[model samples]
Target: MPSHPNYSNQGNKFAPAKTSLREAGDLYGQKEFHIYQNAIEKMRAHDDQLPSLPIITLEIRKATSNPNVNLNHLSSLIAKDPSLTAILMKHASSVFYRTADKPKNLQDVIKRLGMGAIESLTLSHSIKSLFVLRNHQLKALYKQAWQRQTLKACMSYHLAKTLHFPNPEDAIVASLLSEVGTLALLSSLQDYAAPAAPTYKILCQHYSKHLGAILLAKWGVSPVFVDVLRKTGAWTLDTGRLLQLVDVINLGLFHTIHYLQPQNDLIPLQEIAAFKKLNPQYAMIKQQKLLIIEENISHILQLQKNFE
Candidate 1:
């Protein structure tokens, strides 16, 4: 038996656990495995260094919670960060903002995006900056994780549309932010001496979702999104045909990796319980997986460009 390789950076949590050759065909939860216990213990040491919830994000979330809240004050807070303000400007002009009445200024962008879109994009741009690590090797690893997340986001959006999900944007945000725990774990271990990549991955599997939940709660991300984030690690956890954000991302993520690995065979959609629950025929997914991923790749990147 060969060792199961965790897909570098994509962090596809849904596949069957990869067993080491020594433990071939055996099953073990990486999170509960004892080998990486010491590495997992190190995760909490740098909570203080984890990025603080950006103030503008908080203000916007607060405003969203209160119907009577002053929109001007919320817009003012966002405008304080010129970079964020610029991102909003670009988004307001995007096709996602397909209004005959184009936004003329920051206030218009605010009105155009509303509380939900604003919150998603603000946190996406603001919080991701916190992933920076002084260690060059760790920094490169973090970049791969972050890029994988963008693709996941796109896939979630497309999957939601295919499945007729009520709110695709929420699914996209949940997918993108689900990897925060992995990012935090990498940051925590960046300075750890001589970490074997396998050991590092074990620690990641054990703790990434939990860390993501903590960061999202601290950042004031809505619990709906947080619940979806927490559920990503349970790749096979399905709740019937009533598809939610978690299911959307799980299916999207599985296909995203399949698209990326054109030369190799992927786990069939028929065998994946998550894909089966969506009511698409096994043959339908096999036929359309590439187009689903490739089409959404352009759409998702275009959305990111709007924020860029």
Candidate 2:
């Protein structure tokens, strides 16, 4: 299993709480350990407060699941949420899908984007609501979190489509929900004093994957997604099989950190187990893989912005 340079030392799998706190103390300063500890305790104690998928999103999914579902009915369901309707309109007109004639209305937008893209976009829109925060500092963190996740979703969608995956929406959902644990933590911090940025980041690195898995399980998401969240950042994680949604997310994260976001502690693409597995499956050279992302970046950014 490949380990992240920053996160590998915490060990694979969720650590026992007491053990995690001790490791937190060691990795972060003692001053911030208590803060991380209390936050975790609060999150666990208030586990029921973790956000649920919106009723409307559930309705949309239930409706979309029908083989003979009505597009007009789907459009009406989405129109109930005006903001979501606006987002759909904007996305349809975005350069990624810009035909000579733009989609004229919600129904047309739905037809243009297709059921898979609509479902992914609706889920992505619903998930963003969970990241809204009142804490001034946490607000910035949440914004960054949203942006990173959106970037992941964009990259994941394109990669899945390029690799000829059966359902690219699965990759979109995985990328969108990857940092849900971080949102779970930030959501719990409404009345609490926000920790310093560095401490808050350390807290997320240590706790998000575990908490996200728990929340997704509680919300009854697919086991595949729950597993993906739990194993996030396990870069060398080879399932010793064909490419999976986890590989899509791993590749997305690599692009986000190394290329899109450009972090300091960069890891080479060759070192990633997912890249090694996925790269050849597409039969593209290293530069070509990056080129795929580079070519679609503006479109991805447009989708990300419209998603907001």
TM-score of 2: 0.84
Error of 2 at 226 (Å): 1.4
Model 2, span 1-308: residue lDDT tens = 11122331122112112234465456555755576567676776677767778899999888877778898899889999999999889878987678999887888998888887788778878888865678887687677667667777778877888888887868878887777777777777766677655455566665676677777877677888877776667878776677888888877776766544343344566777777775544545454246677767777777678766
TM-score of each: 0.77, 0.84
**In candidate 2, which residue ranges exceed 4 Å CA deviation?**
1-32, 260-263, 279-289
Q: Model 2: how far is 44 from its true place, Å?
A: 1.8
Candidate 2, position 57, lDDT:
94
Please, what are the lDDT tens digits per residue for candidate 1 over residues 124-196? Answer: 7765777668877777677667767776676777677666676666766788777777788777765555245
